[model samples]
Target: MSLVARIATLAQRDAITTTGIVLSGVWLFLVALFWLLAPGGEGTQGGIARLVVMVGTILPLVLIWLAVRTARAIAVLRAEAADLRQRLAQLRDTAAPRGAPRMAEPEPLAEPDRQPRAPAPVPVAPRPLSRPLAESRSPAAPAEGRALDPVDADTLILALNFPDGPDDSLAVSALRRALQDGDHARVLRAAQDVVTLLAGQDLYMDDLPPDPAPPAVWRRFAEGARGSAVAPLGGIHDAAALDIASSLLERDEIFRDTAHHFLRHFDAMLMRHLPDMDDAQIAVLAETRSARAFMLLGRIAGVFG
Candidate 1:
């Protein structure tokens, strides 16, 4: 399903759950109140007793139903978590340093006919995060492209790409480090929360008033990210850096939506133009990576039991 669709579904589920909880609470409270306030006559005793029994029997059943539904929701999240691990692996593979681009464009394909033919197909250009590679790197340690061990590679990646400004990265780093230090449940949960936040966002949530949508949620950001007004093609900003900072602060449920919105735009521009299609490098943290991060994110945010 599309990201937007999934978000809508989660919202619906939340609504249903919340309404059920409220209705059940009200019913139980009213029933209890009636039980205590019943007329103190022998004529009413038997009916009041029967009503208490019915409430007792039905309340447990309702609670059980709610528990089962919650469990199923968690199962869905687990599947998404696995997908994120695979995505991160794929992203790491793509980030492998490729040989420097060979200078000089290939000559136009020789045409047999003299008529004006189309120009040679252009290779998709990479839209590298405008800042230098060093700037985006986390400060704890630096390594010259190291080989990743399935177990430690993720932590290493976290250590390598830490964005210092947000607590999420540090929180994420702690989880990874804990994993490296042999804390499995903690690390796994943390990764899940990050993924959860990215894939689903809990915004102005069920109990809160709505936040108005921005007129151009991303317009100013997109404009400032690349190019000075005078030289759109030549200039670039640290917009990705800003994204790393801002989205981490967003509510965990909807973190994925916020980050992916920007990352997708980056991928479309850089990879969409390539000819072979398969050869272009896209840097979006998507597919499985997104799922993993959300799962971990949920855990860290204290939403996961």
Candidate 2:
């Protein structure tokens, strides 16, 4: 167990013990005072009466102590259980799949036309593409010296979701191309910052199952809709997630700032790109990890009413 958990458990035990002792002491003191003030009749009958009184008072004290101890024990068990669950979540997040290559080292970006290999088992850090965007003859020219394609909606979605692992060649390639564009790179970097921040608090976009709003609702949000009209787009209603996010937004300066930055970039991206996308494309985009992060953070940031 964590040191904080251990300390909390010990504190609870101490409180329970102290309360039990105080109650028992008070009852004993009252009983002794009553006995002194109003003595019983003499001899065997008196002695029997005193013995009965002693048992009566002591029995209740014992029972009360037992009840308090049981409650404290149960509370401690619950605390330990919660602690175990949190540790398990963290372990699941950090553990790489068996036989998956470690992606800690940087690798070259794959060609966009090349067929993607097996999905990678880990996320790779974004690296500079071989050819810089400046090398392109025109604004629409590809980042590579050859005729590279423009960043399409599908590529943008893949880049937003980010590569799941080292073998996620498609996503990695998309990310590489997206990073070459200034606007796409800004949105991508903002999304990444917020995702990392959320992960630090054990909040993952994949774990949050958002309510699936229709494409119309997303379109409305993409426009200038706000308040109740765009509220449906803020579909992430997980109570634990909302509570954690709300708390962080209220208390953590860095988290609050990152969330707002992500929200701004996402809103701008939607306004700029949503017009070119069909309902199907919008739906697909909404399902991406980055879009999910946008929904979660947007709701917390009050972007949607």
Candidate 3:
């Protein structure tokens, strides 16, 4: 690629360092050449000699700093790429079929010498309840037959971003640092890091040029109507739904924290599948999970429905 394209590509990850390093290299070369050719000393232009001396001394240091910064950014991207590759390999291994290993034949048991007496038969009482109390009190509706609405799906997509909300993650704090430093490259890289973390969990923003939500639903959402946000999000449990969920969480601190809690709690559930979690903690996590799912996929239109 051409220099511009190369710089642009690097800009996505470490634009400031990339540009600075290039400029510093050129400046260092020009300064060094001028000093060598002119021999900046007595009988030379005082201002030119002073400028050459200053540039000659500072450019190498600037170049070194830029090079180090670029190297560090490249290292971080490489690490993340390695991690992604590892996860993909793991998934592939899990999905791939494996052949059963061969086993040795077992020896047959010898027959008993004497006849053994049979135990007497005992009658057992039938169980009192056929089902659990929780199941009996609240029956779940059939989730498979329900269809997703276009508008609600769109709203779920829109909910993925919280442009005006504050972020709670360290990555966001780094993003702020990049912004304060006016480093577009670092800013974009930091933003990508945050987005990747969300995407790893299958959350995404559904908005693109064409807009995924129905026009009517979009209007209602844009107008901030109380009932326009309702959608049947409970049934949306796949990676695609995660995209929309992630987008919403990024845009809204409340949604982000809620999603964070849901993910961490669900992770805990997986780790503690043996039912070792406290009843209160389980109840809270379960309720949060259910509520978040409902809000994301439920069919009640409201301000935050």
TM of each candidate vs. truth: 0.26, 0.55, 0.26
Across 185-285, the per-residue lDDT of candidate 3 in tens digits comes to 22232222333333344433221111123334323432434352523223234545645654665564534544455433323322433133333332222
Clashing pairs in 2: 120-165, 120-167, 120-168, 122-165
Report lDDT (CA) for all predictions.
0.35, 0.69, 0.35
Off by over 4 Å in 1: 1-45, 95-305
lDDT of each residue in 63-164, candidate 1, tens digit only:
855875885587457556655555544433333222110112223323345643322232223212211111122122213453323323233223322222
What lDDT, from 0 to 1, does candidate 2 have?
0.69
- Arranged by TM-score with the best first, the candidates are 2, 3, 1
Total clashing pairs for each candidate = 33, 4, 26
Which parts of model 3 have CA positions greater than 4 angstroms off?
A: 1-41, 91-304
